[model samples]
Target: MLSQVIRYDGSMTSPSESAPLDGDELETWSALATVLEWLPPVLDVQLQDGWNLTHFEFGVLYALATAEGRSLPMSTLAGFANSTLSRLSRAVVRLEKRDWVRRSTDPEDRRVTIAWLTDSGAEVVASAAPAHADLVRRLVFDSLSAEQAMTLREISRSIAAAISDEGGWRPGR
Candidate 1:
């Protein structure tokens, strides 16, 4: 539930950007905002309950699992996981404690650190993937028509491009 709404009161408007959202635009933004607010915790619950991992941890593990040789440089992993290096580093530290991931300085370039998914990490990812996929399908795909799904993909890509251009990570970059 959206607990608070600071509706436009015309108190801080400029000449060029003075107009508040139109009715259709307001409704669209509200729905999108609600989804943004709501989706993560739902995804988190499945990962936490079934695999004892947070969504970001699963993303890190999944990203490494799909990378060549089950590893990536720290910066590259952070990009793919759509996280900052510091955040990724903290998650990597937690995964290391579980012996699910390991970090090593690159043999040739000493400054570059690499994260590798251990065999144990692979096992956890393999175990969790299907259930995660099923939940996603049930919650998202099942609710959308094919055309709507395609539209969603395009919209997501456009939004991703815009956000990435503003200095956010773009997966597959």
Candidate 2:
């Protein structure tokens, strides 16, 4: 059963005990929400301006580039890219038009479709990687001490796991 939303004064109650967020909790959550809304466009702008690739396109290519045999089944690639299969297919089609990726069926299991990064695709990813890394470092890591970076890694992984567990999401499902 779900609890009813309760409002006291101008503030809504928290899920538990109809408690409102205290000042510190409210500030932390607001900051996180702002970052979530702001970061994706910043990343997209950098990638789009430099490489003409949306972050999603770059992610798909990057995943294939780092994979063994430079290939994965379309379903697996979609999962790795955090995209639905239909969206991945459309992106793959665009990449195919650019001669960056190729698609084929698995010989042993014809029902399965696979995607492979072409030599050209490998070249593109290789060329784009340094710039991407630089931007990521500048935007994300430049301000952090090594200790803070490690702490962030631990915190982010815990949060991600919690969200995934609650949503029943598996990266390669």
Candidate 3:
């Protein structure tokens, strides 16, 4: 349970006042929240407009394109893409329709299915990489000072670690 009070001033009482975000902390949290809300769709639009792919689909294809022999077991690929098997299955089906990827039974494990990037898929990913990279650089890196960039990386890693520890949501696991 939690509680707060607002006095005559237009300020929020911190939760129980035992712990509270100070002004700077509140500002930082708000900024992070805004970025989290806005960044994904911006990213998805760039991929969709320029490459005819959603970010998740591109991510799946990109993962396969970078894997050994341009292939991975479906389960492994889902983990790498940070997606559920069902969602990854849907994305793979769309990619297969585009001839960008193909599915096969793993030779060493008949029970396992593998996703492989087709030649056309590899070509598409290669072509899309530059534009996507440029957009990311512009939106994220271009605004940061070197020190800020390093701080952002460190902060992100720390947050990811905390999430993994608390929620058991490690990617590529």
Candidate 4:
């Protein structure tokens, strides 16, 4: 007769004897988990402390700044920011209030609205860009030698491609 016991940590201590995952698979899983845990906070801290922006806000501004005519359709901006339309709209409202952005209907297409980066927005982004790049280098690239950085980039791209193929992934989706 077997009796089941629950552990205090909410995990089962007694094993049913499942097969173990391969070492590479385990490493991949662990690395992904660690990245998920670390990436968001790092972004949040750098944006908030360094730039007075949230990650999403920075993304929206960055997209518009780099876009043609410093503008983009709201739908495209949403995709670029990896955000829902509603969320992007709200952020746009906040940016407008700050005089950092403007919204207007596209002259050629009344159904489409365009987000434009204002002079203030451009100034803010320009000021923040160096700090943001420095943070990225410190957090990611600076620790690696040039060859290692190149190798890591290749490995990351390959992994990204494989994951995209397996999961039907979309950039910013």
What do the candidate models score in CA lDDT, each in turn? 0.88, 0.87, 0.88, 0.84
TM-score of model 1 (CA atoms): 0.86
Using all chains and alpha carbons, the TM-scores for the candidates as numbered come to: 0.86, 0.85, 0.85, 0.78
Query: Which 10-residue window of candidate 3 scores lowest in summed lDDT?
Result: 2-11
Name the regions of candidate 3 deviating beyond 4 angstroms: 1-22, 168-173
Colliding pairs, model 2: none
The local distance difference test score of model 2 is 0.87
- lDDT of candidate 3 over 37-105, digit per residue (tens): 999999999999988999999889889888989999999998888878888898999999999999999
Tens-place lDDT digits, model 1, residues 1-173: 43343323323334444467879999999999999999899999999999899999999999999999999999999888877788899999999999999999999999999999999999999999999999889988999999999999999999877765655444433
Ranking by lDDT: 1, 3, 2, 4
Best by TM-score: 1
Query: What's model 3's lDDT at 97?
Result: 95
Winner on TM-score between 1 and 4 is 1
